[model samples]
Target chain A: MKIAVLIAPAVHPVSGRPCAGEADLAALALAQRLSSQVDVWYAGAADDAALADYLARGATHIHTLALAAGREVLSPLAEALQDYALVLCGARAGGGDGSGLLPYQLAEQLGRALLPDVLDLSKSDQQWQALQALPKGVRRTLAAKLPLVASVHARAASAVGWSYARLQQGKIQRKAATGAALPQVVLEPARRARALVAASKVSGHARMQGAIAGGEGKSAGIVVKQGDSVEKAQVVLDYLRQHQLVDF
Target chain B: MDFSTQAIPRIDPRRPWVLGPSGLKRIVLGDDSGSRDAALLAHGPAHKPLRSSGPFSQRLLVVAHAERGQLDDAAREAIAAAAILAGKDGEVLALLYGMQDAAPEALAELAVDRALTVADPGYAPEQKLALLQQLLQQESPHTVLFADRSEDADLGRRLACRARLSVVTDVVEIAADGVRRRQPGAGFSLRERAQVLLLARGVAEAKLPFVGKGERLQTAALPAISEQVQDLGSAASPASQLALEEADLIVSAGNGVSNVPGFLALAEALGAAVGASRVAVDDGRFSRDKQVGATGKTVQASAYIALGISGAVQHLQGIKSCRHVIAVNLDAAAPMIKRADLSIIDDCQSFISAFEALVRRERNLV
Candidate 1:
């Protein structure tokens, strides 16, 4: 089965600093874990160098969708995903529109079943079984037919190991793609309300010394060192009180 | 064709039962029931001063799922602290849920003007939200308070949005018309407003106290409704999955814990459940169920060992209630280090390996 991976680059405010999004890395890692026949798609602001790197890693094809600033457009990408059997995206983007609502909105737009926060995915009998993370380390399994959207949460799987051999033989192709019309919402630039008034610096020596003292004090477990039972009990009470363990 | 002419039942818009200002009630929404009850007892009665002060006659609502666990002393202290803050201007009412008989004890311990028990079968998130929403709408409370990490955060957000009110999340300090949030970010500074407020835990204004005693209510006599609703079931599902109140030990990891090499071994060695930070789960390092944070799960283990976590405000809010926090990190400056009972500034991998080795050696010696 062919898989399409969606990626958006992270953008920094003020300095306009550029960084690869953690979500992209997560999606790429998942794509690598699937069968080698998978293809990759890049949406919004991915430079050629990053595209080449993804190609080197095993992406069969890279599709780039050009978007202007402040577009807040997503429907075009959702439309482009129509051809793919299974669409994979990050549960949340790290920077620039990292609302964590994109996947749900996209799924709704596409009218496809969305399995979110999926930890493990396996394919059997033309359907995919997903192990979803519930609260408190409990997991629930869900099954969806092919051509569904899976927005994988960051902790869904281990990072895929990179290999030099795969990098050497991998093919890279770039395709120019058009997205659906940009949504008509006007976005006001984020305004800064406060400025740093003062900054304090602590000497490294003082920090190190403090760390040493803290380490020593912490290593001595169960502060009741006295052999006398009453004294030990008093020490325990003192310890609890010092730590604010009990409410009076 | 004439359907529009059907007379709507005459609803009394200003019925005295609805217009009379309900006593200012405070609810300690927390994961810990025992602590919540203690807090109600400690500070619930003192809130009577608000009636004399005027403009603060709203009631307090404490909502939490009972099946999750009993509130401990620390949670009670937090509630007491909130009660003290709420009492500065209004009458306090306490609502306690969870366990078979928490209502009467809560009613007795708290200076509750009236006690309402939302029985077990009716224990769903939507039901709780709907019931609270109905109460708040009817009472028109000046403020609604909730523990920062409780499942009620979602409810608080929805209520605030629906009611067109501003909510102050993760509040550590609260005063007359002013609130201080706990962390650095947007809306961290003290907000001054007489408008209806929803205060979350960890705000900078008040120090959460730790209590030692909790009241156990009589469950048999409390009013109950048994009709099950599916929406409420989903909302309460997340809280019910946690066994933290009963856990003796918990081993939690964060995004910094990249691989799965040591998790199983640590869980086996410590006989503890494995937990993860929201960042860790978002990075695909673990499942969402393992996540512990504001948007995740709350744990009250006796011993909590944190591995490679920086302890962001959201994550810290959930685990701060744990009895002991043992933090292992390479960075001594990580927030978790400051909060930890035992802070180890060493490689987490080495510590995990050493812990496993020590456990194995001890087992062999036995």
Candidate 2:
């Protein structure tokens, strides 16, 4: 059975090198574990000299869909992923427009059943049984036939580190996407942190209003009045509910 | 203006989700006796009838699902946002699902007049999507609002796609013309049409000026969906301290907690488990399991003594559940000190020693 894993570019925290996202890498590992015939696909620019990180992990075949700019990846990826028996993606992007909307949108575009936040996946009686998570760590068992989408949760499986020798031998195949007719949009840079605002003069009421609107005040608890250390400790202990938290 | 002012989508009741189970099924959630009025009185009789014509004809539907019959924080937030956006003309209606007990009275206490319920629990995602689609088409609502939850966002996108309507997900603000969110790219922020919006939490949190005269409307019949998905049940999430979530008193340390051995002793003296801030956890001073912060674990301790922790906002979020925070840090201006009930400015080692001595003396006296 052919299963495909989708990957997005993520910058390594310390080294600041481009690599696949952690959860996405977990999906790749899961796909590789499920079967040997795993096709790794990415939908953005691949400019790095060593794009072999995915190859080093477990991707035997890597397909990079080259999208220059302005085009929605939804269409290009949907066209590229039509043949696979199963599709796997990280539940959501960890960062960079992390709206967590793409997996579901992609599922809709592909016309397949989507089982998101999948904790574990296994084949049983010719059907794929998925362990799905709901709000607050609730787990549900869902089964579906082949030709469906399953997103990998962060805890799906531990990722195996990449090997140097494998990185050298892994091959990545690039595919040029058929561009759409829509007018190209100008690419924008990432938003930087909010610009620092200069301190402004304010009157009494306005200053009070700013404090309330800015929400700088704590809503609960009283400040401990300055006093002797022992008395302060008593106040602290009084605040601590012994039945709830303190053993004494 | 992009809000649904056009034609309503078509609906077929025979959709794979609406049909009731063909076989006997266990009641997954909700109390049948309390819901005795729920099935029949879902559309409250005392409430004014919803308009199907004129400028005010369009209905405002706020969709929320409850766990154990109480709406989650996000759901309540969405309800508030929807109510605020509805203004005075449109009838604010709530589509509540997954009640495990009697029909909730909370919504009725809000400004909502009518509530549609599907007290059935454990329905599959596909079944939920289908039922919502039927309801949307049936109501032909002018505006629809849902919470920005994982399931709700997925279902909203799918429903939008099927109905050929525009959907705005993760909307932080709703205006007359468009909705706004964080800048998707650089230079300027992005906006979306206001037809269907999935509200992000923490924005709208006000109760209706008056309580909703809410009544339980009969939920649509839910047929069993694809059995491919099963509930494996829930397990407790792993936390830093085994008892951190249950602990009512916590003695936490941060980067300033240099003396690990002494700190542990002091915590033991206070009968408190050790919790570390993100700084300490990141510095390798404490294991990830002992980290206390938003990304790690949010403790609900009654008394949280934070030592040497210059509380970051993320750390503060983790300790928001903490009832009483006692901050001990050298920096008086640290954000944590402002939030703490007891703010002590002193050297970390000296303060811990003095506090420990005081605690020991108090114990000896006892």
Off by over 4 Å in 2: A11-18, A44-53, A94-98, A162-165, A179-248, B1-55, B100-105, B161-164, B175-177, B182-189, B206-210, B223-289, B294-316, B321-366
Residue B315 of model 2, lDDT score: 93
TM-score, structure 1 vs. true: 0.45
Please report the interface RMSD of model 1 to 1 decimal: 13.9
Q: Estimate each model's TM-score.
A: 0.45, 0.63
- What does DockQ give for each predicted structure? 0.06, 0.17
DockQ of 1: 0.06
Comparing only chain A of model 2 with the true chain A, what is the TM-score? 0.70
TM-score for chain A in each prediction: 0.61, 0.70
